[model samples]
Target: MRALVTGANGLLGSNLVRELITRGHEARAMVRRTSNVEGLAGLDTSMVYGDVRNIDELTRAAEGCDVIFHTAAVFSYWGYTREVMMETAKGGVTNALDAAKAAGSKRVVLTSSTAVFGGSDGPKVLDEHAALVEVGVPDYFASKAIQERVALEHAAKVGVELVVANPSLFVGSYDYRPSASLATITGYLGDPLKITYPGGVNIIHAGDVAIGHILLAERGEPNEHYVIAAENVTWREVHDTISELCGVPKPRIKVTRTPALAAASLMELAAKITRKAPLATRALAEQTGRYFWYSNAKIARLGFLPRSMRQTLTQTIAWLLVSPHLTNKQRAKLRPHDDVLQAMRQAQVAQRLKSVRIQDLS
Candidate 1:
């Protein structure tokens, strides 16, 4: 089998490329010129430069590929306007589908997200058949819903086999920059103050999600949607697990929605002033307040079973601890000793001062 993977440098795309190669498939990776290909190191695959929004580029990349895995999208919790989010999700998917059809691809595994389901106040495990709760979903969710609808409709009309995989929050090794979920967990780890949310997310390992895509490509039915989730856990439970694994103190501060929203507002203000991405934003606050539990029974029937959340977190934290990107100053912050924390604080201050100095020079 020949596979063309969009977003080949992203967390899920990188994993999909590796899995396809391991299964003896000729993989072609389509990535932007600026995308980081370090994660793809040592993989036997052809790298093609292309953007998801470019039709000609996508068509060129998809040529002669048997299967197309469309995983490219602008995924972020904050710092994007509604228009930017929608265009990336809907326009990007449309371009991929058109390119795949033009290139004569047999099947396409569209990488969707659980975000399409939206938030529900009622605490029930949402299956693929469950009604979509769209109120208050972020722009990203709205865009995904629109994109998937287009893909499914196109598949039905053209008789092109399309299988949609909706993965929940993913965590595992090779996180590279560490995705939104991993970053959130890392930010909260060992903190004396913790913010608790009424809602939770279904967590899965990135490797499992990647394998699920491969399985769907090989044996999945057309127009079928599979929810790829391992375990549904609350925010508190996730933080506790990370603390336990990392030997860090669990957060004691339990905040409500109002306070969280307020904090996110402040973060957004800071982000604008500093020209940096905010840790929390209005959309994030809205998402955090709603339960996102999902049922994976449909995919499980296809012999898909994922590891426990605890196991996934253990491996993820272990990887971060030894990662070259984690500076010694950051390690000291993780230490239990008070003196270590103070030293880490000083290092952070010095680092900020150095950045300001460099900017002044520039």
Candidate 2:
């Protein structure tokens, strides 16, 4: 079988291609023309160059493919208006599904995000049965919900089977860019995230999530959705693990949801006048202050087991520590907070002791 994956150079896209090749299927990767091709260098994949926002650009790329994995969407959270974010995200998915239908692709798997599931907090945890809540959700989350709605509606009209896979925050190696999740880990391990986050998160290895997509394509029910994720952990738990592993002292400062929201609101107002990104935006504060934990029992039923959070953190940090892909700025940002400070102090004391010893010997 031949499958086409959009956003081929991105975190999930790169891993999806690798997963497809391992399953004995031919993979076609659709990447933007200007993206750095280095991420896909060694992977054995047929490269298709096009923009998902344009249907004509994707028509030939989607031809003869049995399945289309629509993983391409604008995830821009900061410095983007709601209109721009939705237009970019919705247009991309619409074109991809249109291309799939026109090319006679039997199935198309849409990569939606668990961010679409919001405000589902209470006695029950969220799952496929959870409703899509847009009120108070970030533009990114609301846009994804709209994106899914449009794609499914279009798929139904075109006679192509559409299956949706909603993955939580991804963690694992092969994250050359040290994605948003990796960046968050580094911030905690390094300079010490001064403010405490209120909500918890579910993290899945990106490779596992990639394979989940293919499995969904094969066994997933038509027009049904699956939540692909691993462990559900709180922010404190994640930060504490990073501190223990990196041998750094955790920061003592903590900020609760109420104060954080007030601060973010003020910053949002300032950002509007400055036309610059805020230190804390209202949308970000609102989303992070809510629990995003999801149930993955549905995907696990398909025989896809994910790695433990411990293993995921270990491998992810190990790679980031030595990867040439990391900028000096990124590397410095990841240096453990107390470890470096202690090292400098110890060196200063040793220097003074050496001078005293030299005088005694004289």
Candidate 3:
């Protein structure tokens, strides 16, 4: 099968493209000309230059594809306005569907985030049937919710098969720029964290999420949603895990939501004054106040069992430790001692790389 992956340079897109190639599919990587392709190094991919917002370019790229893996989106809490994000988010989905519709693709696997489901109060496991929780929605979640609805509606009206894979906070290797979630990890590893919020994250391996996409395309019913995640862990748990793994001291200060929000407000104010993006925005603080937990039972029912989060963290830390992009200063900050990082690198070197799924479902 021939596949076209939008945002092919992104974390999930890069993983999906590798899976496609491993399955012996011809991968047409559709990315902006300026997007980094370092993650795609040595992969047998047919690179196409185009923006997801461009219907004509996307259509040209999507032509002659068996499936369209649409994973393109702008994921920033700052540095761009809601209007700009809305246009790109909404237009991206619509344009991808249009291209898939024009190309006569058999299926369209759209990678979405759990942000669309909003926040849960506590240990409740949310499924796709849960309606969008609108209270305290940040600009990023709003754009994503709108984008997903637009994509689903477009796919439905056009009679195209669309499978939505909603993955929670992913942690694994191949994070070139190290995604926002990974940034939180590395930032804390670089320096002992002084404070943290009170929320939870459903962490999943990126490779597992990529495989979940393939399972969705192969057997998932059209117009259905799959919650793809590994486990639900609290912020404290995450911090403790990192501390234990990297030999860093955990932050003793746990700020309540109100105080965190105040800190975020101050940060945002300082950011505006300094003309730089805030490390912790009000949106982030509010999000951290609630649990981003979900049930992966739906995808698991389709034989999608993910590796443990600790295993994922080991790989993630190892990748960051050895990354060519990591500066000497950054490495020193992250490595309070050499063994902390050296051990992870050695462990990763001992393990074999992940291979493609779907092709070898036996």
The global C-alpha lDDT for each of the candidates, from Candidate 1 onward, is: 0.76, 0.75, 0.78
Over 4 Å off in model 3, which ranges? 333-362
lDDT of 1 by residue, 1-362 (tens): 99989998888987888789888898888888777676676676788887889899998888899999998887787767878977887788777778878999998899988888875775668889865444567777777887888888777766667899999888765567556767756667534565556677788888899999988998888888899998888878887776666557775777667888888899899998999887777777766556789999888888898888876676566556655557787666664334333434543442343111001100
What is the C-alpha lDDT profile of model 2 across 155-264, one tens digit per residue? 88877899999999886655664355665665565454444565687877788889899999889998988999888887777777676555656656666667777988
Worst 10 residues of 2 by lDDT: 353-362
TM-score of each: 0.88, 0.84, 0.90
Rank list by lDDT: 3, 1, 2
Candidate 2 stretches greater than 4 Å from native:
119-123, 262-279, 324-362
Candidates ranked by TM-score: 3, 1, 2
lDDT of 2 at 361: 7
Error of 2 at 123 (Å): 6.9
Best by TM-score: 3
Error of 2 at 35 (Å): 0.9
Which of the predicted structures, 2 or 3, would earn the higher lDDT when compared with the native? 3
Report the Cα lDDT for residue 146, model 3: 80
